[model samples]
Target: MDHLLGEVRAAGGVARVASLRARGHSRRTIENAVSSRALTRPRNGWVAMPGADPLLVAAARAGVVLTCHTQARRLGLWVLEERPVHVAAPPHRHVGEVKRDTHVHWARPLVPRHPDALVDPIENVLVIAAACLPREEALTIWEAALRLELVERWSFERMPLPSSARDVLAECSSHSDSGLETLIPVRLRFLRLPIRQQVWLAGHPVDFLIGDRLVLQIDGGHHVGAQRRSDIAHDARLTLMGFHVIRIDYVQVVTRWPEVHDVIVRAIAQGLHRAA
Candidate 1:
């Protein structure tokens, strides 16, 4: 009925027939609803209310569940790359049709997945991402997951992680302000420099304070308007106080990484990341 359509809409306009039945709609009611054009059976066991998420519908048709970076991005978790539809299937199940630009995973899942799930479990997604992505890149996503409480730190600790993955998690700080904040540590970790995060200075919390007097301010896409002006004022105050501030945006931190690296290296050579 009306409640059923609302549920369907809430569930991205599509749901498993079994789920509808479990929600107290009788089998006959479901059939009648479909017959009355109130719901449409998109697949053998799935019903959709007019317009479901096209991506999810396509994934369902392909019999592949979204996983790794793809699922992370969809869940609003931190992900460096966005292209290529990443999907996963159990080792025994046949995945979707082979196509260019489609990244399919056939590895056994670290966590159990429901038979009809259209998306991989969050833990599974992180595990796969940790193993597949560069250690530093993976750290941001894991840290973001931890910050959002989407996944518990203990859960990752309980999972069997390789030495490399363990190292990444060990450095994952829940205190990171954003994915870019997490990236600062990972990218600069190899330098063995003393780094502090979320440091309080002049009545504002800066993203990172490196060594002694250097601060890093990471700005995400929405870091504009009053916040941006306030940050600029803070930077001026910090500079006047003999603190070096390096402010960068998402693209400079995530995409133009080498440029960021060179800047950091030169700043270190100039002793900018240290006390005067």
Candidate 2:
């Protein structure tokens, strides 16, 4: 029926037969619809509309939910790098079959997953990501989540996070404009110097204001054409205003960090971070 097709489409092009039944559809009706090719059985009890997301369909087939870093990336958070497809199997239950490229998370979820859900909630994504990734990499995603208002700081207090996750959360702040911005202050925290993020200066917001005068700008992929020109003009203006500027690109921040670190250190050694 058209109504049955609508229900499946509303559930992101996929629906569980049990859910359809709960919605007052009969088993015979569902079977008839499937028999007429109006819906597809992706797995035993799951029906997918035509052209459903292959990944979600695959997850349903595997009896898991797309989760962890994979879900974080899907949510537009700042992830350090791409990894294999990550999924969470129901705790204490055996997953039937999954793609070899899939990374399965078997940990108990901090938030309960709905039986018909194919994607993990943002909270579960962060907690699982924190446990799975390295300390700093996980912190990047956490800060992005905070910055984007996806999760509140106090919300995590009630959850049973492990020590490592707690440690990472302690370092997270919503002030970070991007994952790279988060990385900067965290890497320089050992200096015990005053650091601020997204500070207004020279009529624009700079990525970071270290100490009193140092302005650090991280240029991501979007810094091209008009944006790039504006950034350069702003750098000139900030320099004229007596603020030290160190503008680095994505590669320098992610791949060649030590070099960037040395530059910042040398600038500090010369008191570039201090007000004249």
Candidate 3:
């Protein structure tokens, strides 16, 4: 059993219990380790160390395209909302019978070859992720995938998508946002404010731009502690450069869109009026 544990650890920190069993680990040994809390069952056939992230374990077990929020987080994408675990299985595989909490979507007529391939030779998880994620979340994943070079833009372009999915991708391609950033732009657009999405300022990225001077920041919960402090310092630096910075939190962006819009509109009007 100790030898089996070493083998599992060497295989990227995850392995299927069935694989271990096939490799000569006794059922009694498996049960004992699981009972001792030395191992955890992330999915039906997969088991890992107690501290392993469940998402990674599941992806490793499925042996197919594990993506969307799962891949985004794995690739270190800045994701705001937690989404269901999405996996793309081969067309003939009976993923539906797996009966796990994950949302498994089967892909019929698989692509000839995935563009942004993984080191493990898995199909382009990024493309599957982009297809399944919400429009806003997809955009965030797409940008992160590009920055990491995990997948190419052509991979997404090449997939055969339903009309609705294609439309969502088209609209989202022009704007990059997680859920929080998406809210800010949607609110600004509804209020008829001239705002640009993902505008770069002084080497830092701002969520929206109101003309040349005002930068809009959407602060999600993840932006706390050291990150929060860094953001404050960046805002101060922008202020020193004669730029106005308006920051809003997730609650303001989600529940108080009108109030948020009014505040930004007033600020923009004031800035423009002063410039005039």
Candidate 4:
């Protein structure tokens, strides 16, 4: 019983009752774990630790699994939204409010889902997300998956893609440090201008170098103290070298896109991104 409880906790505080039985624990032991309050049967077939994530438990109880953005967020992938629990069920299954707010996805997964699995596979999540979210956001998740080593680029390319997913994946780049890093180039791809990533300059690397002289820096919240001071000093030296450095923060790139776009356009108009 102790082993079973520990195993459940190790499995993100959740496991199917059958999984415990398969692990050589008898039915009686599972019931005993529940009786001892070390685990709770959130659904008929699922046993979970007391601290199991409520959203996942709810998905289990509702006979569905987390998918798309919801599963991406849970997997520690870069995600921009965190609301309205996104779940996947069989195309025929009817959902009736798992545990308050929910967004039920009816799109059939590109590949068949595992019958006993309670979480969407990473590739399936990306496939469904490609069809559900706008191109840029979907590509961000795909790039994030690539960045995190959650999936390999060649294998993902080999997988079947429906709708505009193939086109979206074509734009995906694993070179980005974050989803926000991807955002800048993806949003500006229409200009047909040269954009280089992780460019070496002044004995350091800048995020993006447009044309020959423009340096576009996407600063996440992590830039601080010595790192921040170093970046500032680099910005000064780059300017002295006749490079135009345009630094923007998370909010500007993610939330206030219009302003960021306008600023970039003005910079280009003034030939800041051109060779001096």
RMSD of 4: 2.0
Worst 10 residues of 4 by lDDT: 93-102
Per-residue lDDT over 1-276 for candidate 4, one digit per residue giving the tens place of the 0 to 100 score: 778878887777778887778889899889888888988888888888897898777877888889998899988888876667788887887764575667778877776776567789898899888888877788888889888889888887888788577887888876799888888887898878999999899999899999899899988888899989999999999999999999999999878989989988899999998886
10 residues in a row with least lDDT, candidate 1: 91-100
What residue runs in model 2 are displaced by over 4 Å at the alpha carbon? 221-230
Whole-structure CA lDDT of model 2: 0.88
A best-first ranking of the candidates according to their lDDT comes to 2, 4, 1, 3
Better of 2 and 3 by lDDT: 2
| Model 4 alpha-carbon drift over 4 Å, by segment | 94-97
Candidate 3 weakest lDDT stretch, 10 residues: 113-122
TM-scores for all candidates: the values are 0.85, 0.90, 0.57, 0.91
Please give the CA lDDT of all the candidate structures: 0.81, 0.88, 0.63, 0.84
Please, what are the lDDT tens digits per residue for candidate 1 over residues 230-273?
A: 98999999999999998888889867989988988888889998
By TM-score, who's the top model here?
A: 4
What RMSD, rounded to one decimal, does every model reach? 2.8, 2.1, 6.5, 2.0
